[model samples]
Target: MAKQEAKFDLYVFHRSYFCGKMMAYMRYKQIPCNTIYATLDKHGSDIASNTGLRQMPCVRTPEEQWLQDTTPMMDWFEERFPQAPVVPTDPVVGFLTRLLEDYADEWMWRPSIYYRWHTKEDRTLYKKLFVDELLGGFWAIGGPVSWLAGKLVHRHQEEKFLSGDGLTKANRKHVEAVYINTLDRLETIFQKQPYLLGSHPSLADFGFFGSMFWHFSNDPTSNRIMQERAPGVYEWVARLWNATSTKLGEVKFDYVVGQVPEGWEPLLRDACEAYLPYLSENAQHFEKGSKRFDWNVQGFLYPGVHVSPYRVWCRERLQGFLNALSESDQNRVREILEPMGGWKPLTSNAHIQSNWDPEGIAPLCKPQKLPLMYKLKSRFTGSNHVRTRRAWMKD
Candidate 1:
């Protein structure tokens, strides 16, 4: 068979979390993809016209098909182009990979955004790039207009991410500790192996890689911390980027079939302990039809954070993965999770079906454009909510 070319046009800002994740994934797969900056002024209308919301990392395929949401997009890619598969065939391994991916996708987002906006050095540089993405297409580039746009964007991020989500002077140190713990765990894993799974960069690696490669490794403050503390993890970022699917055949994928890598236990522990409970809380709020709810992860409270219908969908997906397992595999997986206090949240609610997107159309869908006047329901809308509030009609 000829080497297939899957050329895709990607709309993304260089510093975006999911954008970097998708880019890294494409590079590893050796897919023909081009990165097009999805700046607010230039591609804002294009994004609004194409996908569910004004979000970055939207994909336009060679066939002119539009895709949003990395989780489903990657799964679609794995099915459409099965060359050098990243998802393992072993049922246990595959299930664990999806669980880890879901955790990385939904949970790590808070700390990832926090590092970019909360830390002074990272914020100083990132704020300017952010303003340009939002207002650069306008007539005046840098004076008073730029200043105001920056102010609004910065304040919105600080509120929505830093304060709104939950950051108290009391729990601030604890939040930083969560990020550091991840770095230390990943650093240890990288020190032992080339990737999170085995020889190949599995879904687990790509899931974490989106935030690690984009925000932590590149931003000034977090980058410095990663360099000083987790050098191995920093190096793995580049290693995974440099790897290609065709080249990975050189390494043998030797495993005991069902055993999760010992090195991955800490990451799984964190996901079970931290990520699952957070999902359960969000699911409760969505079930109650409440607009906002308290977030108490590991006993640290982030009260009154807005409820997310999207995350309820995420929790539902995780539950599906668990339920799809074979009876024996489920029992073994339960043994691993129950000790870590992970199993309850996944099974506590007998029925967890989020009616957010009932038609099963995601990544590929008919356009459903919301009125430009309406605020985007997704939290990671690049602060488009604030931008629309003031600069609704373009800067």
Candidate 2:
């Protein structure tokens, strides 16, 4: 008899965008995994105890190791299961794919959050969904208690997403406009090819699955817009969601190495034009000890956006990846990015701290400055020895 394969334990909720992305990726790769729903009332404590953080879409490896952060998780899994490579082999194409993935991961978050929680229709719908998923049948106990709990959850998310620095009336139009533009561009791509890169799904496709599948395709208002305006993209979301080994096996392996499809250029250009500038400005402000910063993209002003050290770290990671590429590969990528205004930021001489922590539990926008004593101690004992107790505690 053959030995049974060990299945990965995934801690997630059905309606979470990040979780959807992870699910799509794992299913596409034909990885054996089982879902463990992290309900707010029942399983929330289990997740917190396991990871020391409340974030969802965490993975417990076959070896009993816990992992978070979708990007790193994807990388780790790819190394372990090298049969289906989501990352492109060509350096230039790989760099571009990573850029798109990063843009989808960070920049698209604003619109995703806004479209999900800002509108009354969406708020009412998701409140029920959240309550049902988190509390299960607890609403049967008492109407008032269930209603109050649902209302509190809705209000908290509304304040965080709609009223907070993430989304406001001033920038709402800009965010929606960006989303529409992205959908239009993506529709064109899906019309030409099944996936972003080609026949086979890549990191770019899964990156988009995070927002498009869970929020835009699931939320009532956004789903209507997606179905009406960009049915191609909506269908693509469904396809990614239901992807499996059998389905993926039917796709011909026809993706040419080092070739990016023409449809992707416009979307990539928009990312470079809008998100790159925002990231560049945010990094500058973060380094200067500013807690809040903002920037304008395509004549739309976004004011009072909080400085995120985590995002700065993301930018630095991308730049570091570019810098590490061979000169020929760098030049090749520059040719692709230069016309879109991305080359400068991608190759910027910005000072990135070497000792910065990439822990997911770190405060999203808080400065990651080390105390003088800790900094001095790190020099002698190596930076890894520096304690991140305060950072974890902040979350």
Candidate 3:
């Protein structure tokens, strides 16, 4: 066991944000696992045969069990490997950690993609990397086929993500502003503390790592901004990457209202104002079966935001965590979240009728559905806002 062996098969894409999240977590726990590179064409059939979808960052255990979805996958790992835990022990702290984690995991996702493809240099690099990953075995990488593949990916991604997600000239700057504001806040926090909450990396840190490490800090556009603007946050990316569980001491989010880390408020405020509200909108659109609808996140009007059933489930998950809390703990959490504008969304009944993951057996079992579309034809979907099988997509 170099680092720490778990005999786990982690199927991953090098640049996938969720993969980066898993990488940071497994590294933190000192879990030695093998990463098996997976693409829809080469590995889709076998993966879909097991998990019902071809979402990457999915893991195959030593016992040959398949697991998908990072939220539940982390739950599975936390239950199994509770050493040097990233999750807080106290119920109130635990719930808060999960809330921040969900925000970073879902809310920061679009902005992360915005940095990746919107930037000319990073987009070109990612397209080249994508070609090598997908078409490397077909021929010499810089050849005509590779060139065509890269071009196809760039076009497909721009169409599917950029225009499809409604990233327009008017709001593109707003998207970047969100990211920069996050960096500014995080930089301030890291200057005061080693991790987001404290010295040990919490679930919140790993969640942010999904986007920051994989996309923002790595991309040339945001990377430069990070290096110059928020060097502390930039340093944190590597720190978390190399972090070991040995340094993970007692975890705490139980501090009373005034005693909690001051840095958390801004992030949580944005989550309350931006992420939770967006989730509410997504749930509404999903209920209406709208293909795309207009919504303003943090005051930026995104006209064609895709309605995600999965995010509706995300809202449910948050509400579940909140409901499970004791009255006292719930009140304590409210002292923090209520003033920040998050309490209402977690408590309000939006008539969300999603039957997904009913058994609470996530990461152990998968439901028979896809996140966005049930099928997509494109050979390369890196799992941004949509995930599905490519087998029937080409049809």
Candidate 4:
């Protein structure tokens, strides 16, 4: 039988890293797809609300089925299009690639968005005029609509920030410093080779590229810093999106970890270090059973710096996940970073019953859990509470 015809359209934001990641993948594989620009307030106008997550990077399959999130899209793509594989054939490379991709989606995205909107004064730097241009015809459908839509989104962001969930003065500094540190380290790695996994661009490269291209490259404040401090990394981001990487022989895949050029290892270590705080903070929050963060807040925050039940559970999960990996997979992770003292594995301070030691700020009393703006009325059955804030637009 013939291969099935391409199915589905993409609902995306031009500046969404998640959207960009999927788009780059679709482009690389030469998949045929329709594109829709789903701006913030216009969400109700699209099928995104019908889907569980009210988010972009959603896919509408040829069957007219809607799917959301990067991981699910990738899973669908891998099964449907197997000719040009984004996953590596080698197990070690594959595992590491998945880990890096996860890190980018979760840990990196929060701060990246913060820097895009809050870290800078200029709003035009990151807005994509092309997004409106692409949907120019839609304006006829609703001319003043886009302007109103943009205002709603801006208001939404402001309200979320003021809700006092994600961003705090300390966390902002922590995120800013780590964001720069991550780039500095990543730049060194790109300097060594074209892609993170070396010679060949893999799934991980696409994910990281999404974060870099969608946010840093588009935002004025971060973009300027990127060019000034990490020109090579910026160049690599552009290269991956190039139409040519998909075609064979334009770029060869021969880079191996040990064979990588000098100065790359240190950069990676620093990136890893920068990543730890967010990871630790999330784990702590989960354990404390605290809804300290607003679902819409753009960064990580924890009232207490010390180890909490959340951190203990998080560390346990990490250990279990690591233990489940095949020996060879574990060895590969160790080998790649052997130059940087290898994988020491993170420990839970709570489990050890040690005093809390946060990476930044002076020690303080264990803080109280912030009340959630709204709580899930029913656990796991998909129920939530509606909050009453003065500015909250009642639905």
- Measured by TM-score, the strongest candidate is 1
lDDT of 4 by residue, 1-395 (tens): 99977756887767677888888777777777888776533552344234433346777667555665575467567777776677665555555555566556655765676776574363443222422532233432445765643444444444343223355665677667657876887887788787775666777677677788878876778888899999988998887787434564443444453233244355446434544444555555555655553321234453433223423333444444556668876666667655443254343333432122222111111112223432222111111123111110111
What TM-scores do the predictions have? Answer: 0.91, 0.86, 0.89, 0.67
lDDT of 2 by residue, 1-395 (tens): 99999999887888888898998898888889998876645665455455444457878767666676788678878887887688777787788888999999888888887888788898788777777775555542548866876776666666544565646567779989878999999999888877886678888889888999889998988899999999899889888777775666644434555656568888889888988878888778877888776667787766677677767777887887788788998888888788889888755757854234546432221224445665443222112223423233223
lDDT of each: 0.76, 0.74, 0.77, 0.55
- Tens-place lDDT digits, model 1, residues 246-315: 8887434445567776677888889888888877877887778787887777768887787777777888
Highest lDDT model number: 3
- Angstrom error of the Cα, residue 235, model 1: value is 0.3
lDDT at 392, model 1: 16
Candidate 4 TM-score versus the reference: 0.67
RMSD to the hidden true structure, all candidates: 4.6, 7.2, 4.4, 10.4
List the candidate 2 regions with Cα displacement exceeding 4 Å.
Answer: 135-142, 250-259, 354-395
Ranking by lDDT: 3, 1, 2, 4
User: Poorest 10 consecutive residues of model 1 by lDDT?
Assistant: 386-395
How close to the true structure is residue 28 of candidate 1, measured as C-alpha lDDT?
79
The collision pairs in model 1 are none
Model 1, runs deviating above 4 Å: 1-6, 250-254, 375-395
